[model samples]
Target: MREFLVEITTTIPEGTEPAEVDRRRAAEAVRAKELAATGNLLRLWRPVGELRSIGVWRAGDEDELHEKVLGTLPLRSWMTLTVTPLESHPNDPGKADAAG
Candidate 1:
């Protein structure tokens, strides 16, 4: 699987009810845990002092990543996402082991 860097910014629609926001938030949390348990989600972090999130994910390809991964997010409609593919650096930890 390929690794990807995902940046997400979320904004509920204007005039969205508070209860709806809470519901979506809860659903999002559940999705996160499911992804993590499946080893598709690597790391997740909420940027300090910012309202955005960053995550590392693994997938067979970009299309699968979009469809099977991002598409499954509960807040997909309300979130703007940027995805970047990742490559292992020569000096990266465990690179030698992987190369061998």
Candidate 2:
């Protein structure tokens, strides 16, 4: 599996119904939980007062990450994602832990 760092920004179109937004948000949360259980989602963080989030995810490759994993999100249409592939570093603390 390859790791990716993703920055996600979500926009709700103007004049959309509040209930619809709420429904989608609920669905998105459920989808996130499912991805986490499958080990696709590693971590997620949001900046204070921002409608954006950053997360770490894993998939076979970029295409699989896009087509199979991220493509399945309920809010995919409303999201703009910047995906960066990660490479292992020799000095990474996680690598050290694993070695020890």
RMSD of each: 1.9, 0.9
In model 2, residue pairs whose N, Cα or C atoms come closer than 3 Å (at least 3 residues apart or on different chains), thus clashing, are none
Q: Against the true structure, whose lDDT is highest?
A: 2
Score candidate 1 by TM-score against the native: 0.92
Candidate 2 lDDT score relative to the true structure = 0.96
Question: lDDT scores for all predictions?
Answer: 0.94, 0.96
The C-alpha stretches of model 1 lying farther than 4 A from their native spots are 94-100
Give the Å shift of residue 75 in candidate 2. 0.8
Predicted candidate 1 versus true structure: per-residue lDDT over 11-70, tens digit per residue: 889999999999999999999999999988999999889999999999999999999999
